[model samples]
Target chain A: MPEMVNLKINDISVSVEAGSTILDAAKKANIKIPTLCHHEDLCIAGNCRVCVVEQKGVNALKASCATPAEENMEIFTNTNKVREARKTIIGLLLSEHNNDCLHCYKNGNCELQSMAKDYLVDSDKYISILKNYEIDRSSPSIIKDDSKCIRCQRCVRTCAELQDVNALAVSGKGSEMKISTFMEKPMDYVVCTNCGQCVTHCPTGALVEKNYIDEVWDVLNDPSKHVVVQTAPAVRVGLGEAVGLDAGKSYTGKMVTALKMLGFDAVFDTNFSADLTILEEGTELLTRLKDKIENKKDVALPQFTSCSPGWIKYIEHEFPDILDYLSTCKSPQQMLGPLAKTYYAKSMGIDPKDMVVVSIMPCTAKKFEANRPEMYSSGYKDVDYVITTREFGRMIQQAGIDFETLKDSECDSILGKHTGAGVIFGATGGVMEAALRTAYEIITGREVPFSNLEVTPVRGLEGVKEATIKIEGCKAEWKFLENVELKVAVAHGLSNARPLAAQVQNGESPYHFIEIMACPGGCIAGGGQPMPVNNNIRKKRTEAIYNEDESLQLRKSHENPEVKRIYEDFLEKPLGHKSHELLHTTYTKRKKY
Target chain B: MTEINIVKDAVKKHGRKRESLMPVLQEIVKQENYLSEERLMEIAKEFDLSSAEVYGVATFYSFLPVKPMGENVIKVCQTIVCDMKGKEAVLDAIKDKLNIVPGQTSADGKFSLMAVNCIGQCSNAPAMLVNDKPYINLTYENVVKIIDEYQS
Candidate 1:
């Protein structure tokens, strides 16, 4: 066991580990310490001095977040000096901040606004010295507003640590210090992946997703337009947090009800297309393997999954030379988009032009993904608008709908049906596990060796996970005796994916298939999920995702009735001609920096 | 060597590690007088770092400017001791001679004026650096004479 350090926090004896901070000790003693720069997901940034606490016999107040709790130390969390220091620091921060809360995008959910209210910070205490910075709206996914930034560096740390994409950096020093892109370039001109991890971790209104709520509202009000909506697999588990329900609770049914009440003509599920992704992507993987191992052709081994738009953009920028290794499958959101404008419109007898496809996604990058020129495969724009789960919650609030009291409802027919494997696509290693479940069965003509098809080895919050499955008893017309061990790797967050990408780039990889997600935990803790996401919330959302998968009757993707019917009636088969035009897309190389 | 090759040579002289970032940047600034975005990007590519990270470090030090500078650059100390010692008058004199204020290069491309933090010349209260050479205990005449000598 680790050595424990004993301390007295606010006269309550608290025992914590030796390396624990005084903030940790205060948490143990149930003494709440308000902090602005300390985030559970980032390293201790003591720049924001709001968490200063009084230590006995010490003239200078200690920053509880940066100071470790020593044995026999006496710390007071709510002392007068501490309170005065916090209020003064907050007031100073406000003097530089543009306190236009009424006109701000993050007015209601901003952490700095909450702290100012908690401390009753007098904004007029100091003269206003706010720098007028031009708001950067070059990227369709996120906006960078500098006037309201408090320079807490949480977004900087998040971009550097979690994503390993240092598109943001602390430029200058002292009062002139600001978070900026390279040479102050607009975000679109730089190497930013539009992941929006910076947006989620921002304490102020500095970084926010570009809002399409008003456009969505306009579409809903237009009688001439038949607006159809699709919800991603992660949105079902994550929307609960935005709608004031507890985290980890699946709100799939109620979310559909809310979309219907909001005047959507049809509410579909992205999970259905997620099932379709497995078929096409799985078939592509098998084809590549056959070419490499059986036909003796030079092929890119270890095909990478392409469901995440952020990961797609990252590889395009960082590893442009290895674009051939990425699977040609479009993300489930993009797949559903074209299908909605074409197949769904035809089946429902609605004109494709009049049908506006909106995706309620757990990602901000989906907004950029939908706007890509290649997404216009249906002769019209595939997905019209992409809104985050948070934006959808705001829409529900705007419509004055009681989310909790809404009766649970089922999704509309054609593109709404889903399976357990599709629902599990929200989690990190879910796509790998789902593919293995179907591939193993297809190869051996038996159930996957895993109990109940859990595939426990690939599941969880580990940054990178590797699993090997030995193929046995292969069914073939003229069999070459084979006992091949198929190796697969799963990685979430760009930092973990970097090493794997390097290995692939150098032709040193030892896996047949690799799964990569840009966000930390997966789509469940995506960039556009409810705010204040950390490892704790990520775990709860992952558990809810697994629970959702178990609750469904159809656990395998191929077993999805809608998927089978799509192949039989329309697409014909996975990787077929129809699937190529709609379900698959290509990637382009970007500037290396 | 060209500015691009100079940055590459600096990176080669120092290693690719993070500690070498400073020496590489300082070497470029020493030869070029200021860092261009292109040279910064070249250093970033060679060091395997993001361009924003290199830009951030370059901007953090007032000495390492990201914009082009004139042939002769003048840095006036703007710390408390120099401020109390009539540093503003010294800055005003430089502005009058160069037809430029702090953070601006002259129209003739002869001089650039900047009010930077202390260069540890506090004992000689009001001090300024003209191309790495410090001039201390200055007045309006001394500042004008200093500028006149560099004008040719």
Candidate 2:
């Protein structure tokens, strides 16, 4: 869109777009600059100071990431001064860091490990100042170990700018500087939505999703266990990247094959449960509207969708006073957990107690959520284990499974059947779109006009999105108006949801429905999807979700024959006693400190 | 339900809501001079959360009082900018005069010594907050006299 600027990096001339940083220009010139805090997706923090380069006329070495490239600028990437500064920065970071990489969860794949090797840092140079800081393992999704933190501000930037959730911030300064929540509270008590965007962006072992890989492996190895794995909608779009596949490549077949190799007895799909959620949630909305009009009964206004575990947790913690506004339906992942243990196990003639249900998700919060005591709705542990997409990839590598060569396979029957509406649940605004498709049909009692069901209002990467849908001519005259405008809002990241929640809390806002996802861009950019994600990758993954949605024959949730069959055979009806037992869940407020 | 009723009911009846936690903790600290383990456990159970989670959150933040505070709370800013402007000496003077450690409360409960990372008053250089009130441009000699004024 703009003119290109030519720059010489290590005596090689490279032309990059105007406003490109020296690091980007160097990348174009094939000159390597080691960075810890600078993520392509996250805004440049330049706090790591590891990418310093010697400029021709500058008095001091300039950080390549923060410094903009000028025309005909000469930069030396490997000068002694540049090397010394980088080494010193790495040395300082190492001195403060807990070098217990052997036992650390990040182990061999840690960026800090690779950076140290590339810079040839002397680990023992500086005297270590061991601050007796406590570890925060209070949250279900993440574990915060400040001892290993380099104060690079990657997590802060990811939380604030990228995710639009200011869950983490730099508190104090200098040697005492540490990242903390409001008043240094545990993440669970703060405004954090449990989105693992911070974990994906964290360069070191300081932040990590609590690992459930060991638990899954243990369950799989046990002779008495019948382990079943269900993959979420977003996992198929990004799991390919973890194994060196191109970003946004759909690896549903390879993912299933890999899971089968991982010793899963049956590979299921969470998409089926996603379709189920639309039925229950959509039916609930219609029932509320009907009752409100016919019986003059007051139902909960502004029924917030409870599809994202991170968003659910955020609302539970930050806006507990408005708990009634949240939809009672458990997330599709959570719903699948109970269904797999009880319904599927019974139908297959297997004992529910002997079944271990593992969910492969694009979320870190789902791991934390599965462990919540209330999640066991099937008289046994519904979901026994949870693994992020990255962890699943690591397991594939660990088990020596060739992900690329894996054969295409179909998901298990019964719980695997999904409509296009369910597949698009991977991206933000997808839930609203899917719900509207069903809602329109339910209201009209006929096929929705124009098979190309596109609700363009709720699409895009904006933190908050809104739309007003006018339902035309309905047969249910008592409750339905000719043009009943349904006001809806969708917010992805928790930071954006905070103000919206605050409005609902303060009674200043009114809406018919709301959809909130914890991670920015919804599950497509989940905390567990992939590492080193940029805006481009997120966009590509989101496009893949919509593309999958468009190519499907059954675009509406209500039209899925399997979903209707499940309802008739097992669930009985949407929000029925059986449905409530299987799909609905309650939340509890957490202590601030 | 009315909004006021909801807020009042939540504040008075539901003790577990996170929004109410800050206010409840403030009241508890105000009454007991510090947060008690029993109170924290009660708060945790009320919220359907673990005591460890509550304690971890409590200890992580700087505002929450874990131990009994003195009649007067003396917090000195020891962040980078303050350190550069001689906040350390000011802190040392207060500790020396009171004969108490940074986290200790005096025997008479007249003063509690603590060092905060920053008070966010960069223009004042070395600053101290006494019981939530800011006192800026603090010197070693000035700190002792300031405490003397609070003694009465």
CA deviation > 4 Å runs, candidate 1 = A477-481, B1-3
Q: Over all chains combined, what TM-score does candidate 1 have?
A: 0.99
Docking class of 1: high
Candidate 2 chain B worst ten-residue window by lDDT:
B1-10
Clash pairs of candidate 2?
A: none
Per-model TM values vs. the true structure: 0.99, 0.80
lDDT of 1 at A127: 97
Best candidate, lDDT: 1
Candidate 2 CA-lDDT value: 0.82
C-alpha displacement of B110 in model 2, angstroms? 6.1
lDDT of each: 0.92, 0.82
The candidate that wins on TM-score is 1
User: How close to the true structure is residue A303 of candidate 2, measured as C-alpha lDDT?
Assistant: 85
Poorest lDDT segment (10 consecutive residues) of candidate 1 chain A? A474-483
DockQ of candidates 1 onward, in order?
Answer: 0.88, 0.08
